[model samples]
Target: MSKTFLKKRYGLLVLALTASGVALATVSQPDLPVAAAYKTERVVQELPMPKLTINANASSYWRDEEVRTGDTLALVLQRLGVSATSIQNFTKSSPIDLKTLELRAGQIVSARVDSVGDVTDIQFFRDDDNGERNLAAIERINGKWQLNTSNIDMETMPSLRSVVITSSSSGALSRAGVPVEIRTSLKEMFSEKFNLDELVEGDSVSLLYESLYFRGQEVATGDVLAAEVRTQGKTYRAYYFEHGDTGGNYYDENGNSLTRGFDGQPIENFKRISSPYGIRRHPVLGSIRMHTGIDYAAPIGTHILAPSDGVVTFSGWKGGYGNTVMLTHDNGVETLYGHMHAYVRGVNVGTRVKAGDVIGLVGSTGRSTGPHLHYEVRINGQHVNPATVALPTPKLSAADLAALKKYQQKTDETMAAVRGLPVMVAQRD
Candidate 1:
């Protein structure tokens, strides 16, 4: 054995070990993006099953059922699992008659069913033709129960409008593309104050009324918001306002209060009365009676206008006065007109009459000996001379003055903007 042979064997073993280590390192390195693209799919292990439990006692017992139109009470009872005897007893004891059970659509029925499939309680809720709901309840007690019924008032805000359509202005309004509904709404709104029948062909109307809308749909019109009327050469303005806690009357921009507290008087622009106001021999009565109101002899059928806006407290036949109309204005003022050919249609009790409205034609109706209108004015239920009664101007408070100034400025600006424009030529239809 020699030293040279031992060294050569040891060197060969070390080189072999080094070569094997390099080959192992190359195999252990991660693959590049391109090489990983073709890699084989790996199998995933299944997860363990989860435990779950549902308590039946905590579940809901009530069931909901939709009611269809033409469903009968017998059918409803059968659907609710109500026994025939129970239905008969319910029909007998029910406050609502059984024959009235013509079920409507979109109704809801709530029923409580026991474990044995017996109906414990049944509630029937259905909508009527007017879209009102009729609710009924039946409770099971010892295999027999009584029926209870009640009417539920649904809070609904319906839009309403009143329109006034006359051969005169209504036709023009219609031609202007104003809707018929609006016309009708306006008429209703001012029906109490103005009479559409009295409107002449050339007359014009200014409407102030409220329109109601429900969910964006126009439903109806409320009271008159405000209004103006121009017939012949006379103009009348009416305003709507609410009284405050201090019991003061409300007035509009034109300084006219909402009420005049009188009935029928010549509201048209008239000169001084021909006859004076005071107790004198009644020209028609032929007896010395107190002349309560001054006589203003205008043309025949010259619209007997309202001195102030108010309600028609009395309108109808008065024994000697012929066809008469009376209006109770705000603040304890009342006016009366007697001896008329005919009254404006729908000018009855509770009608809101406005200033300068033609209530009736001038023909002696009751005790009048001539075609002249016998007019009267009363204050606090006592007859007063209409000619000499000093009328008060509507006053403005500090806050109201400020508001008025602002409103006036805006109105002036609007008028200025339209000053140079062509006047809107309203064509009479």
Candidate 2:
């Protein structure tokens, strides 16, 4: 063979062997991990929880009612959602004398009944010199009936207001932001002493009174501490003085009692006068006849109060009068009440009652047309017009006069505080 051909073959074989060694070295090398692109960390926080409250004595249902004129203890309790058995249990277990409870009209009554229509608690409030200090409760404790009497801690604050009578007494007092009860009390205080109907447009009045607060809210208005009324260049002042046994009465600066001895109308706050005490056309008889007594038109079962202090002479069914009641007063005066639905319990013959006492319930059980009271006032067997009769005023005792003078000083201090204008917001609990 030729020497040049051999040299070219040898150079080709060396180049191919060098390329294979470089590829083997690249395939056998280990891989390295790449660095992460982001980092992370955890965070936590805590929050507070709220508190909850619950009332222990609250029942599933509650009811409230007002004492009616003909309401007995059982009737009132029944109206307040108390069961018949519950009422019997309460009356038997009660420690208070039910007979001594003067259940007057307009009294508030409250009851709490369970889901099964069973009364759980029944409560009634009464007032004294300390302002609603007595609480009568009839409740079920540990599945047994119980009656408890407790004293309520009331916060009493004095309030004052002065107003000029531009037109209406109630209106002017209302404009001055006086409460309805307070205005009523003020009117009643001076009703006998001064003629409210004779008040002119320019008359002025200043009043100092008390307000009862419970749980930061005003619950009731207390007695009128003092009042000053100016009419026709004359001023009349009344201050309330409390005397033990003699009772509380409003007395003037000279210690003269302002309350009248006799209430002319037999029914206080009557609806209207249906018939006068004169010759009038009979509604049922359809003829002109003499109406010996005044007729007070009112709703059924309305209260019939006594006109004066007297003893019950007769209480029973009478001809044309149905349930009739006769009272004998001082000086041979006789008052008769006719067509009564019912007579007051324990008010039989020889029962002595004071003025404003509930004697009977108005009804139309006899020969009548509707619910009304046939009130007759006879002086020596002669009927007189009750509307025109002049009532007498009683004189104050020496002890009452002496006590009133001392009370006047306290009223003066209260009036001085009242003159500051804009009754301060009562801070009470």
- Residue-pair clashes per candidate: 41, 0
Best by lDDT: 2
lDDT of each: 0.51, 0.65
Encode model 1's per-residue lDDT on 139-246: one tens digit a residue.
655545665422321222312112232466656554443334335434433344566546775566544334332222222223333444556566554443322311
lDDT of 2: 0.65
lDDT of 1: 0.51
- List candidate 2 stretches off by more than 4 Å: 1-153, 197-201, 263-399, 417-429
Off by over 4 Å in 1: 1-274, 281-288, 390-429
Candidate 2 lDDT, 1-429, residue by residue in tens: 468855665565567678776433222223346777887878787878878775545555656565667676668878866778777877777656776675545455667776545677666644321101244556678867666423333457766787667787667776675665456556655666676656778787778777654333343455567888888888888886654322245778998766554654577576577765543333453322335566778877888888788999999988677898999986456888898888889889999998889999989878777888887665544344343231334466887677778888877665655442433323221
Q: What C-alpha root-mean-square deviation, in Å, does candidate 2 show against the real structure?
A: 21.8
